[model samples]
Target chain A: MDFVQLKKNCKKDASAFPGYRLALLGDCATQHLAMALKGAAYEEGIALSVFDADYNQLDAQTLDPSSELYEGKPQGVVLCLCTEKLYEAFTLSSDRAGFADATFRKIKGYWDRINAHLSVSILQFTFVERDDRVFGNYALKEETSFYYQVKKLNLLIAEGTRLVKNVYPVDVDSLERRLGRDKFSDPKLYAIAKMPFSLEALPLVAFETVGIVKALMGRFKKCVVLDLDNTLWGGVIGDDGMEGIQIGELGTGHAFTELQRWLKELKNRGIILCVCSKNNENTAKEPFEKHPEMILRLDDISLFVANWHDKASNIRYIQKTINIGMDSIVFLDDNPFERNLVKQTVEGITVPDLPEDPADYLPYLQSLNLFETTSYSENDRDRTKQYQAEIGRILLEQSFESFDDYLKGLDMVAEAKSFDPFHYPRIAQLTQRSNQFNLRTVRYTEAEIEKIAGDERYLTLYFTLKDKFGDHGLISVVILEKRERELFVHEWLMSCRVLKRGMEEFIVNKMIETAKEYGYASVVGEYIKTPKNAMVETIYAKLGFTDRGDHTFVADCATFQPNKTFIKE
Target chain B: MERNEILEKLNEIFRDVFDDDSITVTEETTSSDIEDWDSLTHITLISEVEDEFDIKFAMKEVVGMKNVGEMVDIIEREA
Candidate 1:
């Protein structure tokens, strides 16, 4: 999008969409950046209200407790430290050898002070790489050169931000590298006004920033729904046979191989991969099973649906089986007809316009950054196996005559315990990513999760499930705030991968048991409606709680009977 | 390019940047005559004009251009 179009988006009505409060602090002029951010967010169906701080007020706003930033009560803060200002500071510094370390310390101090005052996510922009060309090629050898220092500072920001739980480093340096420095920055504009980014680059920078904000708001892609034909490989599997499909080191085949490698890495990082094809199941399975050139195998896919059905309906079925929101699924297809059909039929699905050349596929998709996430843990790597196990349970249920007998045959086991430090990452991840099974849909960061675990008034429970198939690690999270006579369910969310199992029944039983043991009179639960959370609209009623006219439900602990489940807790 | 032609193009750009279709700029028009044409919009307006005429306004021209007539002179000379 251009500057004019984005500026026009600022006037569009965004009241119906979800709103987010953000404070923007920068060392340079930020008025245009704020406008671009709000305008870009509007296109994504988000009403972003930006509190644009004055120029060069990063220290003042963060250091002072009574600053306007604190008064605005923003949920997130965006810090933009431009390369121009950093270069000036570097040139003026007396100790050039220690510049990077000193700069990083000051940046970390800002994060420490702001976090001490307010528990909000910080979107820290990495410095755009600039060189004075003072040492030319030898700049790489000289540690004191601005080029070397800036590169070192970027690395410091990346490693240091990871140590802070809530600071997310937005890689503006990488963006500049991709767009080329000439297009990304206009020196004349910088000289005229303190604007670090050119008018053309503001929209893109705003886009990347808003992507993180959206992910923080629990709106991010969870699964990639892929096509099998010309999209994944070179030719049709049904016609080309396993040997004829191009997906190896020969010519354009390497492109498909690279794309597959990227997709496999994403799958390893916990994004579920699924197959939806129009060819017969055997035809699609032949390449994945027997083709030596294929980078993606049957083991990588969580769900495979290869039938001659319309891709839109097939994607919906895949979504239902996987139990993720339609918005969280990104459908990739080379055929424009199929892409248009899915885009028009599905309400919130993301279907990118795949380029005609297969060689351009991976780069174009990477540029879109479809799968932006806020948290990751070791448990994420096991997500594919968990979903694969869910498919196994589903198939086993079909062979059984009765539902209860099928659940019993699985020999399910579960554990519900208070939140511990070891399981905090996975627990917090569920609260942010879970949508369909989420009650109240309250997203929390790891820092907030740690805070809640330590507070005495809040009771936290994390649930894990395992069966003969595999283990679902830390699948559910519950936070209950203690009232004088009752325990109010502050937050409750469960992974959809464990939906059909008796996990909810087991968890509800544990909640009531815990309440009675703590000498509480009653347990109360609530369901707040979101567009993607309709699956749990009547969860409080279904779990046998008294509807209290409001969106809340209550059960007297003394009179409550425990829910029966096949799982042995 | 003709002087009148440059003025016509500048009028279109001024309408677009100011987000006011009723805006019309002649040789005598200046920043004070426009309600929303402040320092920020002036930058946007100059950028828009530069892109429209396929030219780059020097830093001096960006800040020192006094009126619509002066902007038209730069466009005519650059285009």
Candidate 2:
């Protein structure tokens, strides 16, 4: 879809709740990135409104600190950082089409300022290798410098992002990968064309970058479900038997083992791994428990169900157990029948096309990028062990049949911490991906979240859950913006794994207490209807908040009753 | 290849770029003669012609490619 069609679709699709308002800022040089962003927004279910400005008509003053451009509310704003504009901004005289360095600085400065207000801002780094082979006949070394300048601009964008929270660098290198090196050598062709790529590249870049923006701002899937047999290994475990199955060194067997190692790595990246296999429970358990070659032990699986059940039904069982939306679950199967069946049966579960070759499995699964993240920290590496601990927690809960009994047996300990510098990245990620239990569902980029927290007008809260099992890491976030005496709950979402565990009670209770401490009259909640968030339609009502129109829920802080059972820290 | 043969090869590049099978070629045929000869396609067509003929034209020569005649003359000189 083009930018216009994608925007229209995103506005109409009920799944992309908390729609985005976008501003496309650039001259001719940046138009393709704008187009690419539009395509990406459509794919991501984000409502985008684009305003393309004429390069020659832009006024430096408007993009300055005191201008209204920064004042306009947009979910995300994209800027083109090409050398053509940079050269013009540096050298062109005002009458003929030149601006002072101050103007360019102001442009960059204003974007930083806007990022301080917006939820997400994507900056397209300057692309080298434009079709300039003949236009300005520079030597080979000069062309190398031109390419070096793009890298330098990318660094500038990266450093500039530190000043604004949700500022993200779109990899121009990856964007240019579509354009082969030969396209740059022909002077007859390259001289007249300023843009490097074909018309096809524009929509694609816009679409993919917008996806990056949404991923930075919106919610991602919470759980990754695996099918055994050919998916996790080279051949069917039931057919090959434990001894014959591929899980060791050399050939196709090593491929399956490598895929398992990758999945284990993914688990470390916080994608919960659940096994839905059709095998004799005893038969499947043999490799997991006894085989030394097994890369994924029983402890590796967050939820394991081995039976003859339909794969989709088994996935639903796990989803219900976790209390997460089907949209947040990614199912992988080597069998096309099982994959097609789940795709037909489950409306929202993402089942990527399975590869036939065992060697292709690792790349195919990795390419799905179920746990794609922009920023990586040391703590993310330990996500698997935490989920294993959660599985242990689930097993511990089975000791009691009743809900209250389960709560009592763990001697539940909940720690509530306000947002700090350390938890910023995790909090930003949770806000982007947590769906079913999200109230309001306002997505935030890292820069936007930082700005929101820095501003006195907004209060952001992050909750780290650790029951008797262990720490669930930073799994939940609540964003509130001040409106006179009221704190408007702009964004509230919790990782679905922590759902039904009374962790929501712990967080909401904290919000109520916080409202009282801050002297706010009422703590308002919102339940914006989204295709994936139907589960949270009654979350506010269950928490004793009065429903208002347009999915807003309200409750007075004075009369709020805290669920006394959740042990607070 | 002589000038006539080079022009014939160049004509093929033009036909492919414009996606027109029945396009007539002369020294005076400009991009305006056929559709799909926008800026991007112009680059593609010229690049293909240069590769086929093993000769590169200057940027001024490509930009000055108003008619088929100018394109043929540039190719003739370069080749």
Residues A233-286, candidate 1, lDDT per residue (tens digit)? 888888878778888965578989989999999999999999999988988998
lDDT of 1 at A466: 87
How would you encode candidate 2's per-residue C-alpha lDDT over A1-569 as one tens digit per residue? 43334323433544454566666565444444454555466566665666554442234423454443445555555665444555444334442122322443555765655655555565544444343343255423452333333444455556666655566666655556554544422222223565534443455556556656656654576688887777776666788787777778634778888888987877777777898999988887788898778898887788888999888888888887766778778888888888899999998889988777878877776545465455656876676666567656676777778877787766666666667887778888877887777766777788877787788888878877676767667778888788888888888888887677777777778888888889999988877787788888888778777888777888889888886465547
Q: Model-by-model lDDT, in order? A: 0.91, 0.67
Q: Which candidate leads the pack in DockQ? A: 1
User: What does DockQ give for each predicted structure?
Assistant: 0.47, 0.22
RMSD of 2: 11.6
Ten-residue region with minimum lDDT total, candidate 2 chain A: A95-104
Question: What TM-score describes the B chain of model 1?
Answer: 0.96
lDDT of 2 at B21: 69
lDDT of 2 by residue, B1-79 (tens): 5767866876676665555668768776766767756764565566557667777778787776687778777777767
